[model samples]
Target: MDDLARLVATEDVRRVMARYVYSADHHRWDDLAALFLPDAPFIASTVDGSVQARMTGRDDIAGQLKARNHPDSVLVHHLFSSEIDFESEDSATGVWAMEDIVTRPAGEPAGMHGYGHYRVRFTRLDGRWLIAELRITRLRLDWTY
Candidate 1:
């Protein structure tokens, strides 16, 4: 890919991520699921490789997250400093710096405040980029529940 093409692809990838953040924060589970490939995997872990949770496929990812996320919960994610490189015209790898906060509903334990890097593989499918695999490795993770 030329520089111009790569630039456009990077922006497209970022747009997908922004959509993910919006859907998640808004608790739009199905919309969040649609951002991934049907068989995509979502993995979360600590920096030392102790896996916290892993969900495969878009439906499983959406369902599990929806079940775990209480209706009154508050979640926010901030992503920036993305580094995206195209491996081919239809495939790319990226890393995004992220900080997030999750607050549980009243009467339950509060949730987590975290800083992490999202390492992802993206593939262009049906004219848009979708996450093929996503891994979150926390640099600092603090949780109460």
Candidate 2:
């Protein structure tokens, strides 16, 4: 692809990443699920390299996220410094610096603040960019009770 096409594709992928954060934080489960490939792999791990959750397929991924951010929970995700590289016209990879805060109900534990990097693979399916693989590696996590 030409420079212009590549730029456009990169922007599209960035938009999708932003949408992922927005949808999750807003509890838009259906919208978030639509951002991934049908059978995508989603893995999340901590700073010590311990896996937190490993899920395959959009439905499972969405369900897991929803469960974490329930009705009495507030989730905020911030992403920055994204590095996206195109592998082909329809495929790319990216790594983004991220931070998230989760606040639970008053009766429960306070919640957690985390910093991480999200490594992801993107594929264009049916003319829309979708996440094919996602791995989140946390750099730090702090909890409050």
Over 33-138, each residue of candidate 1 has an lDDT whose tens digit, in order, gives 8899999999999767799889999889999899889989999999989999888999999999998899997777669998999999999997899999999999
Candidate 1, pairs of clashing residues: none
> Which stretches in model 2 have alpha-carbon errors above 4 Å?
none
Please, what are the lDDT tens digits per residue for candidate 2 over residues 27-46? 89879888989999999998
- What TM-score does prediction 1 earn? 0.94
Residue ranges of candidate 1 with Cα displaced over 4 Å: none
Q: How does residue 57 of candidate 1 score in lDDT?
A: 91
Q: What's the C-alpha lDDT at position 76 in model 2?
A: 94
Task: Count the clashes in each prediction.
Answer: 0, 0
